[model samples]
Target: MQNERATDTQAALGTDTAPAGIYIHVPFCRAKCPYCDFYSVTDSDRIPNFVDALLKELKRRRGRVPSADTVYFGGGTPSILTPGQIERILGAVHDAFNMMPDSEVTLEVNPGTVSLDSLHGFRNAGINRLNIGLQSTNDRTLGFLGRIHTAEQARNTYRWARQAGFDNVGLDLIYGIPGQSREAWRAELADVTRLKSEHLSCYTLTLEPGTPLADRVNQGRIPSPDEAVVGDLFVFTCKWLDDHGYRQYEISNFARQDPGKGIDLRSRHNRKYWNFVPYLGFGPAAHSFLDQCRWWNHRNLAAYLADVAAGRLPVAEKERLTRDQQLIEAIYLGLRQTDGIDTVDFRQRFAIDFFDYFRKAMVPLIDGGLIQLASRRVRLTAQGMRLLEHVADVFIQALE
Candidate 1:
């Protein structure tokens, strides 16, 4: 079943739609993953100071933003904090902002750090959703990725999370690991699908520059998967989930469809990002966007803490997007999901016909089988999703 929430295109283009959200970044980890590049440090000693600073930041930013319908606690492992710490942060948010009664509150949990009691306590503390990092069910793969949890621990974590009363749980999985075979990918996908979580994020592993994994690949410690193999696996992954009854929403996101219950479990907080909804971000290295202005916090924890201690907004840099830049972002982001682009909405929002304006870019993409044009919407074909990076490049250059 399609999700009940309006597509980002409709909401952004439609009048009287104000989507505001809150994102809290927990920048601490027990140990940094070899593949992780997000601004997290392996220092838990300073969490108390960070939490105090965060609440102050929240209070300080009051009145500058609107009430939010969604709040997400993501990080280096939000589960690492005590339930009380989490509750305090959520409490500060409620005290400072006009949070909706049924706000979708999510907390990102890692397999090794959470327990049944803690999960239940988190629920009691007001988190209604859990996003667990279960990248693979293969112990070998887990080890390769520097994960502290075993395959069994990951499964147990899911069971415990369910028992702790989280109906909207999301499972994060990764494919396209170096030396990963189709059989391995199949096994991983099967392991997760059987768990029946409300949402699944099947992402292809990328060796982002400067990460340990990328450095290893550069030095021949491991061979990067062949591009063709990754491509075939991506197709297989999409078809496999679709065949299993998960609704593919964004490229990496799929919502479960339980015919018995008739529920659509798409992520509300995440939908805001692709939908161009406004959001406020706190803690070090987090980003916020609103009113065409996009800003990010300090990337270094020391800098972040110092600024908050001194009553500063810790923002490192911000930009106000021009109308032309917004147009470019719309095309790139619109094509990243199954919803594609709504031409009519685009015309209305930007006061220009997408087809007439982007004729040169759209026609070749349409002819090349990379994009499909409909009466009201234009979307990427299955082939296009596989080659999206290249397709995005074409659109980016079209702006030039």
Candidate 2:
């Protein structure tokens, strides 16, 4: 039965007609952050075992994907692994998959976890892009977020990445902290733009359920994030980054474009997620989607490791989307990007008239200056992004 399913999935995935990506989730963290809900544990001792299990999984899933053009090492903190370990993993990836020669290999690094020499080693280990987690420029805010590194260390890490010959570097920042003012966020943007990294992702902090931050808010220890303030900061950031020569590609991602050189710095791996391109994720809590089916591994590290050790695919759940579910996701994911949904492509793919089907829902949104239907595409205006849920809900309800 499993062989039959694999045969059907392979037939559905096709022969690499479209670009695909690989995502490796490194689940070990130095310490768990209060606001972070992503699966990670403080078990530093298990790193070696985790790497071995990951390699075994990679070998087992060798022919699952035909080709990959992007490889992203995302994490609880991928840089916590030594450069030699990273090299060994990449070597295994090369042996197990058909990696493109010009693949955009990215590694997520947190400040203070990486040193200058180690950064150089990572570069030599085939990591061509670096995404540094510099959540804030304020020390107090960093402390509040339960981050292990200071503001200065984040800056030093960025500098060291450049010194290590990494030209394509991205930085992540968070705004909308409790009691944060619009002006404070503006200053934070000011500080980040000065670094002029190739890419910047500015996300508004969300108090995810079960996270320490959420507990603090629930217990009245910390004030909840102000939505209005976050909205203002979002607007300011869009305009600020635009004026600073950065193009907003996704809702939170801004890439610096050098028109003269034709350098587009948008994250290639992430585009797969938004565009429904085929990609596979490996690790605890990792989710994967190809064709109309999506599956995820066990979120628990022990379960994941045990399954891999037993030479079984560690997937915990799988779902083949119904047409309605696919349409809902198309709207939800399409609206997250600046490119929006291409009406022509939508009609061809799903045999539904994009504008006509959603006419009722798009009317109020378009009239309210929340979305724009132009150039054969439907995209959210800056205001719409602030109320993305409301906009998506309107479209989703119409589909229902």
Candidate 3:
């Protein structure tokens, strides 16, 4: 059965030419956050080897490369790489693929890992955007979150990026952390708004099962924030950001001042994911979606390197989305954007009237103030946006 599934996935991969994005996974960090489950090693020695393997994989996948409009280096802390190393990897990208001239290239940086000089080096290396993790603005909350940088360090990094002439900067923040108060969260939001970032991503802390955070909660060493409080905080976030001139473009993301600029300034690389565009993800545990199939690299670093060394794709697993599955995905993905799902586009792609097909399912949500259909576009209301996962599930089940 597994072999059959793999064969099906491989067959699907050969069928279509999809829009492409590049995601380079930097699998090294100074220290792993306890809440993080993403694969990364603390040993710096592995980085050079990893970079070599990554470049090799790029060469091997060159034939499959499509013209890419966006390239993202996400990580265990991509900023941990030297400027030269980043430049080299990006150089390989240019060599292997036809990168669009106006491609939005983003590098993720941790507050502690970046300096003014490094930020300048990154810009010179062709990274057009910097996403700095500023999980919280309160020092105690920062320590509790196990972040290496203090609140001061985070603020300085943001300033440094701006001074370095990076106008397209993003700040990532987390709310609903254990022991974080409403007032504290409000203050954090205010501080971030003051930074006048081009983009902001706010996420509620989730205690993933089997993570250290989960273990602490189980042992009563830490308490989970009440769900009701977290829900309230989510609403507060949308209102606060919207009032401060940041538009909620997606459920977790907002942008500063200009709605036109905000709409134009979204992470083009990330938009591909929501649009179900094909992307090649390189590095251990990175997942790739191509044609109608998805495959993931081996989670084990050794296994991934061995496979790459042996001239085999380091894929650990693969799945081909069924037509029904694709339809469901389109509904969920389309609903995630602020522009929402377009009735015409849905019909054009799938030969189905999305509205007519899902009217029964959407009626209840609309009545409950969870969704709104305006100007032939369907989008989640502010209330519905807070329960996006639940709303997505309803739409998914309706496909059945």
TM-scores vs. true structure, each candidate: 0.94, 0.95, 0.93
Model 2, global lDDT: 0.88
Ranking by TM-score: 2, 1, 3
Instruction: Compose the digit string of candidate 3's lDDT tens values, residues 73-139.
Output: 9988999998999999999888889888888999999999999999999999999999999988999
In candidate 2, list every pair of residues with a backbone clash. Answer: none
Per-residue C-alpha lDDT of model 2 across residues 320-363, encoded as one tens digit per residue: 87666667777888999999988887776666677877888788
lDDT values for all models = 0.87, 0.88, 0.84
Clashing pairs in 1: none
Q: Which candidate has the top score in TM-score? A: 2
Report RMSD for candidate 3: 3.9
Q: What lDDT score goes with residue 321 in model 2?
A: 70
Q: Which regions in candidate 1 have their CA more than 4 angstroms from the true location?
A: 1-17, 260-262
Clashes of 3: 0
Residue by residue across 19-67, what tens digits does model 1's lDDT show?
5889999999988888888889888999999999999999998855656
